[model samples]
Target: MKNFPLLIILISLCIACKNAKVIIDDPINFNDQRKNLTLAYLKNRYGIEKDDPTIDPRMIVLHWTVIPTYKKSFEAFDNPTLPDWRPDIKNISGLNVSSQFMVDQNGTIYRLLPETIMARHVIGLNHCAIGIENVGGTKNLPLTKAQLKSNIWLVRYLKEKYEINYLIGHYEYTLFENHPLWLEKDDGYRTKKTDPGTDFMKRVRKAVKDLNFKALPKN
Candidate 1:
């Protein structure tokens, strides 16, 4: 009977674990390029055109900022125009790439846009994918443990909130080239990428394997 209080505390902790981390709303400039890309994404994603900018969010695509710090990452995304370096991609949507959420090195998650909105993070799957960008992934700066935990929590939270079908790393996105989720309009718009590497993704998948989401189909 004396252990009843301990049991109650344990139960309370379990309930608390169910609660999600706070997602800070740190918006980027929703410029004209972003607006047009949103419509284009909607058209490709749903095969119909609507006035609003939204997505079905069939997949979650993870990325790494490669920019070292969170503020620099935000600055890179804050610019309305696509970076001048990628002429191939800018011609298609003029919209600079961005993600729905980003996890800082310390595990703090920031919501750059709504969950069901389109982001230009992945090439072929942007129309139906949710992008989660982490702060670091350079050769010198690897991702941290805190970021991993935050990503696990974030992925689970998103899965519960939406009908997420697949969870993939940025590098694995090309594997879906002929699959139904691949919706990029321009075939030539593809770029070589290696952000948020295999090891990070393996850890994330191992943590969230119980969610029972479908694995990437065999190519």
Candidate 2:
């Protein structure tokens, strides 16, 4: 009869672990300055005059850090201000580019910021999109299978938690330019992207096909 209680405890633990994915909390700098910059970006770029830097998260944009290593990738986003190397974007705003979650090459998921907080990851859709960045997308350091698995899990997890309706690769953001979700004010302010590759997105989408996320908008 004593063994019966032990079995119940083990079963409960397994169920709890399965429901809670193992995501490490590795936060990036979202201080006062960063918060101000985000609000400014929302007002200037998207015309959203909000009191707080938060979003409803209607979309999830997947990306891969071309930076090669997890450490370098995290460092690139850890700062509150934009790095000088990204002159193309730094001129537009001082808000450093960041994502809500970053997946390591080995499939470890790290949450960088709160899911509802606005991150300066995707253009035009930052106000409603949650970003997921996978480490290592350079020619020499392509995303691994482990990353694909993690991304699938994350997409499913977020969809379950929020009202996520669309899944897209970074390169596909332009298609939403004229869609109601598109919010960038500057017609000239657009950047080309090819992060987290088409193949990676395809695999992840296929894995979560049952979820029936809305299709990408036509360009």
Candidate 3:
């Protein structure tokens, strides 16, 4: 797959989404500026030294922010600085740390940072992991059909573009604890996460079946 051209598509998609308002009923798109921002985020947040030919993305880790809406989620990640809890990237860059994408309850997929760049969504495998955050994982507000659909589309997009092999939920990331870390630079470190849910990942896996990727049964 042509990763670079797909990136161009993603950038155009991000550009198209700039004027978009979060409407649960509508299919939201993305824009170039947003795409570039995500790419820039990867560079600043992870301090990726250079692309590693061997660093094949093995999994797509699903997450949830427990936040309310898309606007709120966007504002949260768009902050040029990450919070103190993000000690993982404290030494790398002052840029606020986080995942590659955020899936809103309304099913809007917001790109935070690019997939190629390491995101802090999960620890132990930040370098080879791609994090997808879904908004609204709270008591009253659960993930919606719209969010699920958007997540599926985004997952398929990534798998095809990056030749992604595994898919798992944030709750299941610990399963990769023994897997070798691949930062392509850093020695790697442990990270913590417990967002999103199993049922959610099952649904995502089902959605990406055509890609020939399957979710690892939870241990």
Candidate 4:
């Protein structure tokens, strides 16, 4: 009887894992206005030799959109031009930054862009990195436990789907300054950022430790 109970619990867990879902609520598209801009940005900002924006992802970078709600986050990235506040880089390329996936407060995962297509999320690594942005992390709207679970699942999913090797937070992105993944041509065009918090990353790393993804090089 005791062994039967354990078997039932194991079966239930397997069923739950099998039925796990990450819905695609919205997708940001490259319309007539945005396509040419994206191509120009790819070449000017990242110095990509080819016209194609497709990327063979080598790393996964996580971010938290301080923009409280999913609607606003989507609206903010809908346009292809950089916001006026960022005058420094706007001159280089009018590319508005975006990510591959976004996790809302309730854990709904949205695909903003294609995984193989480049997104201007991580400054130096957009050429070979995939970015996942969470909906809320500001002082007013903090991230939820649901988002943490979603991120853990998403990371594992991406690793299985792609040739992803390194998993890093947005803040840790600067560590790749001189690494091959860092594709920016200008040495001075760097921004300091701390996002998705240290604790959040620690928890994610602990959860996905079994995946055996490589850590950022110390050099």
Query: All candidates' lDDT scores?
Result: 0.85, 0.92, 0.64, 0.85
Q: Write the per-residue lDDT of candidate 4 for residues 122-172, one digit (tens) a residue.
A: 887888888999998888898889999999999999999998999999999
Give each model's clash number. Answer: 0, 0, 12, 0
Model 1 TM-score, 2 decimals: 0.90
lDDT string for model 2 (1-219, tens) is 879999999999998787555889999988999999999999999899989999999999999988777899999999999888999998899999999999999999999999999999999999999999999898899999988888998998999999999999999999999899998888899999998898888899899999998888887
Model 2 CA lDDT for position 166:
97
Rank the candidate models, highest lDDT first.
Answer: 2, 1, 4, 3
**Candidate 3 wrongly placed segments (more than 4 Å):** 1-56, 84-95, 182-192, 214-219
Q: Candidate 3 lDDT, tens digit per residue, 1-219?
A: 669999999999998786343423221222444334435545543554443312347788888888787777666666556667767666655545457777766666666654565554664555677888888888789888887877877776777688677777887766754454433234454455556776777787777777886545433
Off by over 4 Å in 2: 1-20
Residue 112 alpha-carbon offset, candidate 4, angstroms: 0.9
**What TM-score against the true fold does each predicted structure earn?**
0.90, 0.91, 0.64, 0.90
Model with the higher lDDT, candidate 3 or 4: 4
Query: Evaluated with lDDT, which candidate comes out highest?
Result: 2
The lDDT, on a scale of 0 to 1, for candidate 1 is 0.85
By TM-score, who's the top model here? 2
